[model samples]
Target: MRKIQLGTTDTMITDYCLGTMTWGNQTPEADAHRQMDMALAAGINIVDTAEMYPVNPVRAETVGNTETILGNWNRANPARRGDYILATKITGKNAAFVRMGEDITAASFTAALDASLARLGTEYIDIYQMHWPNRGSYHFRQNWGYDPSAQVKSVTLAHMEEILDAADRMIKAGKMRYFALSNDTVWGVAQWMRLSEERGLPRVISLQNEYSLLCRLYDTDFAELAVNEQLTLLAYSPLAAGLLTGKYQNGAIPEGSRMAGNGDLGGRKSPRVFDAVAAYLDLAQKHGIDPVHMALAFTVQRPFPVSTIFGATTSAQLTRILDGLDVTLSGDILDEIDAIHRAHPLPY
Candidate 1:
């Protein structure tokens, strides 16, 4: 694992980031701690979690358990906090369990930041991000019915200012170092950049979005914004929720898997998705590469600066992925991948 410069910040972070969305649900606390240990040993320097995590169910009961599990690790590894970067998100609207589904205001922002700090048992966070735009997003398989016609520009601008002020306060108070966005659009990102530049608040450094060979939504406009603005892309679900791993292929849903519980795979499962997966799987087999490695390496080796935020529920999965971090895809493979994309783009 190699490190990269984090945006315009002086800090350097690993090209890989550990995701803990299933830490407290399918994975036990001991296993979660062990995964954290394994991540550090493997040279992965960043761990990302959220206030509403461990979420196969996404119920009220386990909303904050993932953060608590991570906090438990911190309590035991008291001296190793500085070894890895920490990032977490504030849940946006529709999660009634979190602040009764309220939008993010300056007051709500401060409250959520304070709560996240308490749950992680950390004084400060390296990156604090909005899980999604309060207005809504085309992410999470919602692109088919996506509509932004109802969003009021004046309201959104004021909201951005308020949130930026909230971020400014948190940074000044030593609660967080950077602010970021997740599941946002190009316009949303542009506003943050403009507001930060005009108001001189904390600069937004990164954007965490779903970017995989299976999902190339960010390749055009978002890629342009990231390159010109010096914003790093934190790619989530680079494996397409384990689709690219080929485990879920041939209509076989492994027990205790995400698809087993939520058969839809967050609405990503369809006839076309399976067809796309087969194409990529065939490509991997032809190249004599593991699909997981090929999937991850493709994202990390993108033309844009990106760090893949991948997660595993068990030790075997974790180690297998760690072992393949060095597998670099050649020019032929990339060209083949692009050809495959052209054949079956956004199948889901």
Candidate 2:
């Protein structure tokens, strides 16, 4: 329920952001609207979505349905359009189904922004993000096999400059208020910062990346960048794909759950993952805290300021997470959590 300054922008947003990646796929329109209403009433003012969403299966048919759902909500609740900060992403390089999966160019940027605006039925987006860098990223469990040898620095910089130029034009045109990044690396962020300063382009206000008790990659160099650069972290998957909720433990996959649809939860089903989840669940029990709240609260309490993005496939799940928004871990609990991290680092 706390509000924080959105990077260097004049705008302020809630520490919790409602994620709509499952809106049209796992959740229905009426349920999605109810979730939004609940979130706004709970003082959560940010809603995060993307052009390629409803992503468990990520079928081409459901690609942009998430935004359409949000657009419908905005249209129905015209008086509350400005009540929340609307943030969405432009899918990058690999989504061939998305406009032939063309890379982000000046023309593509313009076109994508226009199309997104039309779909959301909004005059402007509060925060527009590049879903991933053209050069690729090491997130999404890709670190083990990630290779950067093929990336040319000169070519990457040229592309970044061009995209930033287009972003500046979009900002001037009032299509979006702020620009951010997702699934980016330290080097990529550095280049964007340097280019924006030198070229008077739009500066990145935030970085949305996967972060949770199971994934602590952000605590490394990215944490330093976040602190020094004042780049607030909009942490997605704060529950570690729902593993941290303790429901996936001991092979208890509930029907209609994320794992039920995508069996492995995107390569998250490993022997070590269950072990790690068990440890966290036990820790939560020892402290008498709900595992879901414990996981989300821990993320928002990171050294660098963070806004934890949470998604739900059902209204019950959304209500459970929202009910615990006020839960804060104590110093003892945090210290014990650090000890657990040391013992079970990178279990997934």
Candidate 3:
């Protein structure tokens, strides 16, 4: 696992970030801890979680359990706490279970940060991200129906300032190392950059968005913004929710699999998606590389600096992902992938 500079910050993080979304749901606490240990041992230095996690079901009862599990690990390994970068997100609107589904105001921001720190048993977080824009985002398979016509720009700017001001206080108080965004747009990111520059608040160092061969939504404008702004692209679901792993190929959904519980795989179960998967799987087989490795490697080779975030419900899945950390795609392989992308772009 190679370490990359975390945006303009002095801190360095692994190119691969361990995702804990399954911690309290599909994965047991012990196994989650074991996976964390295994990830660290494999030289992965970033662990990402959220206040609302364990998302296969995302029940209200299990809402902060993932961070609690990570906190327990941190408490037990106090001496090694500095060895990894910890990142977590605050849930946005629609999450009625979290602070009454309030938008991120100054009060809610402060409260959410304090609650996250308490759940993780950590004094500070390396990265604190807004899970989604309060105004809504085009992510999560909503691109086709996405509409932001109702958002008021002035209202949004004021909200950004309030949140950034709160974030600055948290930074000054040593409650967080950096502020980040998730499921946001270019305009949203630009506002944060502008507001931070003018208001002397914390500048966003990263953006956690879904990016993969199947999902090239970030390849154009977002990629340019990241490159010019020195923002790290924390690409989540780089494997397209296991579609690129070939496990679900030929209509075979292994028991206890992500698709078994959520048959749509978060709206990725289209016939076109399967067609795209077969193309990538065939390419991998032809090149004598694991399709999973090929998919993961492709993410890191993007136009901008990226730290691909991957999660696993089982240790075997974790091992498979870790094994692909060292796989590097050659020029020929990349060209073939590009060709594949052109033919089956945005299948889902």
Candidate 4:
């Protein structure tokens, strides 16, 4: 695996991150540990998880189990703790099960950090991210409901500063190294950067937003911001919730697939999604390329700095993706991909 600088920080993360969003539920703990060992052996160093994980269902009972599972791995391999860069998130508002549906205030941020540290059984976190902004985000396939007029700039800026102050306090105390954002907007990131610069506070190092061939929302607005600000993108769901793998094709959902559990895959199961996925799958087959590899490599080969955060519920699935790491898209393949994009742009 190639190492890339994480923003302006000295920390270096692998070109891809190992994601464990299904650890305690669809994936057994033993399999999860094995997955970690395999990922580390493959040179995957950055492990991303969250306090509200194992979340095909996001049950109240299963909350925090994923961190506990990761903590178990850490305790067992205490000597290898430094072998990976761990990134976890604090659940944002409307997660009634998390902090009673609280928005991220300074107090909430501090408390969440402490709880995450305790759950992970670690004294320090490499990256502490807010799962989403309190002001709400237009991501997660929720763009149809977006209304920026509903937000007040004063309130948003105040929240950003308060959280930055709290993050500064945490950094001073050695609880966390850097702060990041997930499911946020370009404006949101710009404000965070501006506030941190003006106040001399700890700045955000990364943005954990969803970016894939099917989801090109980041290519334009985020592309400009990321290059100018050096905001490293941790692209999640690079497969578009497994749509690119072609498993959910022909209206057939695998027994243990994400769609079978959450059906609609957070609104990604639109009628047109299958059509867009078919175009990509055909392109991959036409060129003897694994669809998974093509999807992941597309994000990795983007003109900007990005690391794809990919997940697996089973080791077999993980191996399939790992096996194709060397596959790169040719100019002709990329041209065809772009042509497909032009034809089926915004399929979902």
Candidate 5:
């Protein structure tokens, strides 16, 4: 229930953000509403969604359904809209269904935001993010063969300039309060920061990258950048897609689980991931703390500003995660976690 500053912006967001990627697909609208009510009651103010949500099977037909559900709730309870900090993203290239697979340009950015506003039934989005870079990212299982060389330097800079211009225009138009990045690399964040400074456009307020106990990609360069650049880390998949929760241990995927919907969990499933999860689970049990609490708490305890984005298909799951908010780990427990990390550095 604690609130943290969102970058240099005047907005203060809850330490835990409610993620809505599963709202319309793995979770129904009624369940989404119930979860929203529960999350609001718990003092969770940030609710993050994307233009292309209801993910798991991310279909063209189901695109924007999650925002629609949120929009419905906003319309029904107009007074409640001001109670939450809402964020959404504009899809990047490679999604064939969005903008017919065109890379995000100034025009495409405007189009995406207009449509997103319509879907969310909001006059202005609190935080508008670039879902991913047009040059692609190292996240989402692409780190194995990911290469940034495919994009020309001039092209990338031009894209950044154009996007920043669009973001500035949106800010002036009252369509968005601030802009952020998602699934970005350290260099990408630097480019955004540099471009914003040069053009006097909206600065990059946050970077929503994947970070969890099993996935520590942000611990290296990104951590330093986050601190120095004053960019808050809106860490998505903070539970490593539920791996850190220890529910998928020993090849046990419960029915209707995310793994069941997408067999590989968007590239999270690997031979060594289980070992990493087991180590964290063992550390939690040794300290007599729930693994979910340890995992969520670990993220907020990082050196930089972090708001862990967590989602659940059921209210019970939400309650369990919310209960872990106040559970802080001790120094000895952190030392043990570090020892485990030393033994198995990069399990996935």
Candidate 6:
């Protein structure tokens, strides 16, 4: 695994980050620990999770179980905590189970970080992120009816200032290292940056948005913002939540899969999604490459991507994803992927 500088920070994280979204849900605690061990042994230094993780079902009862699982691992292996860079998110809106559907205000941010650190059994988290904007986002199958006009500018600026003040306090208290954003747009990121610069608060080191071969929204405006602002993209859903793995091809939802856990797979279950997946899978086969490898390699090959976060419910899936760390796509394969994108863009 190749390591890259994480934004302007001193930390160097692996290009492929181990994602723990399935830690306490589709994957068992033991399996999560085993996967962590394997990822560390394989030289992956970044582990990404969320306070509302283990989220295939995303029930109130199982909320924060993923961090708890990682906490247990950290407690049992205290010396290993410093070996890997850990990143987790505070839930945004839509998660009624978290903070009773409160937006990420100063109090909510402080409360969330305190609880997260306690659950992880850590003194300081490496990277803390806002799960999404307080306003809505177009990600997660919400692009059709998404509207940001309802948000008040003054209210949003006050909210940003509050969060940045809270982040400064957390940094002083040694509870978190840095703040980042997820599922954010270009304007949202600019506000975060501006707030940090104006208030002398912790600047956002990364932005974790949905990016994949099927979704190239980041290649446009966000790519430019990332490059100029020195904001690295910690790309989530690099495989489109396993849609690009070719396992769900032809409407075949294997038992015990993510799609089986959540039929919609977080709103990625469109009829056109299958066609897009088939095109990428065919492109990989045409080049004599594993689809999983090709899909992940393409993500890592993006210009402004810092780390590609990938998760697995089983170790076999993890191994397959890890094998693609060195698989670089050829110019011919890139052209084929471009051709497919041109034909069927934005399938989901």
Superposition TM-score, candidate 3 onto the true structure: 0.98
Question: How does model 2 fare in lDDT?
Answer: 0.91
Q: Compose the digit string of candidate 4's lDDT tens values, residues 109-219.
A: 999889888888888999999999999989987798798888999999998999999999999999999999999999999999999999999998999999899999999
Candidate 5 structure lDDT: 0.90
Global lDDT of each candidate: 0.92, 0.91, 0.92, 0.92, 0.90, 0.89
Reference-based lDDT, residue 342, model 6: 93
Off by over 4 Å in 2: none
Candidate 1 residue lDDT tens string, 49-83: 99999888888988999999999899888899999
Q: Assess the local accuracy of residue 265 in candidate 4 as a C-alpha lDDT between 0 and 100.
A: 93
Candidate 4 achieves a global lDDT of: 0.92
Candidate 6 C-alpha lDDT tens digits along 148-261: 889899998888888889999999999999899999989989998998988789999999998898888899999998888888899888888789988888778999888887
Clash count for each candidate, listed in order shown: 0, 0, 0, 0, 0, 0
TM-score of each: 0.99, 0.99, 0.98, 0.99, 0.98, 0.98
RMSD of 6: 1.0
Question: By summed lDDT, which 10 consecutive residues of candidate 4 come out lowest?
Answer: 321-330
Query: Where is model 5 poorest over a 10-residue stretch in terms of lDDT?
Result: 141-150
lDDT of 6 at 177: 92
lDDT value, candidate 3, whole model: 0.92
lDDT of 5 at 141: 76
Each prediction's RMSD over C-alphas, in Å, is 0.7, 0.8, 0.8, 0.8, 1.0, 1.0
Candidate 3 C-alpha lDDT tens digits along 1-25: 6888898899998889999999988
